[model samples]
Target: MDFYQTDPTLENYWRGVILFGRNVASYKFALAHALYEVDKSGSDLVTLEDLAVPFSRHLCQHLLHAPKQITSRGSQYLETCVQFNNGEITQDKLIETTVRLGFSNVIDAFHNVNAGEIEKRFFLDERKTAKGIRLTDNFFQLSERPQYQNLVYETNARWNLVEQAWAMGVSRNLVTVEFDEQEQLLFSHINARRVNITSCRDSLNGYQKGRCFYCFRTISLIPGDSELADVDHFIPWMARNEVNNINGVWNLVLACQCCNRGEAGKFAHLPSRKLLQRLHARNEYFVQSKLPLHETIVNQTGNQTTQRKDFLEKNWQAAKNNRLFHTWEPKAEGEATF
Candidate 1:
């Protein structure tokens, strides 16, 4: 997230930032309104995603420019759509049609129009190429399941093009672990951390299914917040507990806000503590981010406590070595990974 934090006053310096996403939100809202109109007018023919294209192009324009927009050149309707929408379109439309049509019934008509109509009406006389088609197809695949993990991963993979820097962003918004000299292994009790018990049940269940691993009480992402659902160490921080060897990951397990707090400082589940050790030793080390929530830290590999200092390290070199981001989704029958 901090990767592009240049001075906000850098004089349209944001011209180069990859932030068409912000404008896309507006376009999506416009599309939604259009869809609502279509439904009310007895024409539920077009779907929400179809209405998203024109505004998506409009989004590309804010970021890329007119000549560079994805629809600049094309042989087919969808292919033409991609020509102007692919991440390269610049904010060149001195005056965007869609922007002018803000909150208008025509925009609603755009939202209600199907891809076939739009393409046939606006994208005639274009040569559709496989390259452009693939690009457009990729976007749809991603919108299907916008898992933050999958999005972040694919973004790093395709966009990184060089050094993968996922560890930082992950910690900033998703999941992370820390260790630093300034804070000599400072640990907090499982109770110290605050969380929304009713979190993102959708994402949590997607990861942990039913039944809490700790209490087996059908845990879920505490609803409301989008924070990581960490498998915590229920015992004291700094690994102080020794009875039943409670400091390990095996003792740790899935815990909701009530269980984590209701028994804060107090021992809850043996598995909660042990699970961290096991998960830690497994390939579950939290990758610290480059964006500084705190100081510098590295992601732990499967084993670090047993290894010699400096020899064991935590860096995103392997995970992000030559990162790539792909919007993953099942293809229509047999599409290949681009």
Candidate 2:
């Protein structure tokens, strides 16, 4: 699915960066967190040294929890941050190292997605003038968005999911993502121990681009919000015996409450063919992301794109043939988002 085509809002572009941008290391996420922090200060121009403080601090904080930040072997900048975390290096020295190494690639590549640059540029690179990067109006405007805090939570959650996948060293075929209904979290078994990865809503919202799966309305990560997102199984979980891995990421989408279980919600009912097509596109987004969900979905569904599509189609056909689920569509269908 074309993310920009459905809703080309600034918030959607930012979510694209966090959700779909390739992660050789987690520098993108740290840079994102740092960008939000710097924006909160109401500063337009930030020196590399200033940005490094939060950038390195976030990496240091996460390093304490998950040591493997990169898919590659090692990162000198990360090593410096590790030293600082271990009290083996001064903060000043850590900042200096970060200014030199941390911004080497993330700044240049931050706006890139799907092999092209996004139309909206959040920050302008100004290192050639020795002034560091300058935040654009787009950056500030995004901070004012109602879902700003949700974006922040989503970024951190995505970072945690990637880092956990990296640290665990689970083979692509062996990664199994389990949902905790009571806690509303996604986790996996590591050495027979449950390791909570992240909030299911936070992780899935990025792929959904913060919109409800059915109506395309903006959803919230915060609690007590009327538009708060619900983790709906695209294919109802009641068919667990008929389908394998009914609660897998392939069958999950974030929907607003009104479209999930309200009077017109799709409770235990089959969605329209158009919605099924959207679900296929949404699952393809997860596979293209190459995140932890990528492996889990591939394992649960199929590896090849056609094979995955066939899996969903087969399940959908079986449910329809059984005549057990009545078809349901939203009363007010918004623009197609997937």
Candidate 3:
């Protein structure tokens, strides 16, 4: 099935970009936020200065992956701003670099629109000359359409989630992977700390009805049972050494020790399609609960239900493509109690 059937807004937004944008990194989301801000101010006009804060804020929120991780010197420009001084690169220097790069991406987007990249008339009503610019009627209708309310809701919802997560010092970080030049095989793992996932279990346990995420068996709370719980990284934690924060509730799930560590357990493997489906349903419960975790998931995956499913599917595919999709063996030995 096409993605639009499951998540119309997200699908449409992506479609808009594929049609109108230059494919610059994260430009779609950045552009979405920019449209939201201008619309909120009851204006269709936006200047370079008007976009600076939003663009900077969006770039600063996530640990971006360029050719390398954010900490790497040659990584994305915004990531550089988040780092401190180290000789030629300082926070101030990075900030200036980001501003220039961000403006360039925006200009490129406009150029794409003007060059008839979009099938519709224009992305902006007023042509962008040397000064500022105004958005087109088509742009507003696309952004503000009633059927697409989730687009705006999801955008703001994610921003709020990120703000809260950052305040609490929780990060949705990525691990970097390196490949050998000749063999084109992954290099050895780099040392990285495990993300603190214990912080989320109590609520997940409650939400899952105390069931293990993979096998659908109840997880025991008691001290000595084999059914005792473990917080598992749905996507194996070891696959990507550079991603340190795979412990977010979006990726963490309650699991029985057997499914977690038994001989047949899935270690660093991508789960079966069934488990992916189950995880998507499970995350929906969190979204329905409207808890802080809900915001986190929406922020990570787009607000639509399908987007979350798509995120897992894509990650699983990536792992498989990299020869990282180890097989998981799920064996059920009737539910045990403490």
Candidate 4:
């Protein structure tokens, strides 16, 4: 079953935009951050100049950390953002550049996911008529939800993951993303120094659509919450010596507490063949998203689809053959989400 369709709430639709929307550049995320900033003012209609302030501010802020925000090499607008961050340009000049060049695509593409427009509209683009966007009722309603702050955090987390991937050149370097069990974050080694990318829960939860990897139950990303998701290794981490890059994105998934460590939880047991197929599908979603994780997974797994499938099958067989590992299946499996 399609997880996003299960609920189809305004929040889910918003998640769809942030989680599943294409990311050629980080513009959508910047626009999303700007939307939230503007929404706080209780303003339904916002001018382009008003929106550009926060939009450019967010891009400049992120540029300081992850310099490479886009996959492509050149961006005039981003250059202006960099100048603004470097104190080379005034804030007014940065805003003017953003107002002219920034919204060229993100405004139209923000609602798009998986090659199509989402069912709900967060904002109505009025660039031609009013030179700005008018926040829709759906957008306002979503902002009022209790999960609003969490959604903002998720958006920033996703942005960091994508930008870090691009900045690190994961596709070329084949950076192995390792999980810090104690910190519950994903990190990679650069120049022999470890760099944390993002919270494992926030990075992977979006791909899972906030559902448990095995049971398909709704999961939370908030810390210290009883329902917070766990960062699970699809092929038990104990088998790291046997399988290459055990901490790779392909091997990581988010699971509910019950499914990760509770009674009858997966633990170190090898997932069932059915769940293995689901794992394959979930990894493929990562590849298809064309995010930074895409090339990392492709490099670690395989370049071709059949080759990747075979890679997983080989790992599954190897794990299954090990006397130390036993096959496992969730007691109460929900619908197939991947």
Off by over 4 Å in 2: 170-172
Between prediction 1 and prediction 3, which has the larger TM-score?
A: 3
Give candidate 1's whole-model lDDT. Answer: 0.27
- Cα lDDT listed for each candidate: 0.27, 0.85, 0.51, 0.82
Q: Report, for all candidates in order, the number of backbone clashes.
A: 56, 0, 5, 0
Candidate 1 residue-wise lDDT, 1-338, digit = tens: 11112212111111111111122123333232232223223322343233444444443433332222121233222233344566334434312333333323323232122121222121111112211111132223323432322222222211221111131233343322232223222221123462221122221222222233333343433334433234544333333323233333222334444444543422332222233333333222111112211121232222343431221221111111222211111112211111
lDDT (Cα, tens digit) per residue for candidate 2, span 82-127: 9998899999999999998989999999998888899999999999
Residue-level lDDT tens digits of model 3 in 181-266: 23312121223532221223343554454467777575654445555677777877765553334555667777887788877787
Candidate 3, lDDT over the whole model: 0.51
Estimated TM-score for each candidate: 0.28, 0.93, 0.40, 0.85
Q: Which candidate, 1 or 4, would have the higher lDDT against the true structure?
A: 4
Off by over 4 Å in 3: 1-199, 223-226, 241-245, 332-338
Give the deviation of candidate 4 from the true structure as CA RMSD: 3.1
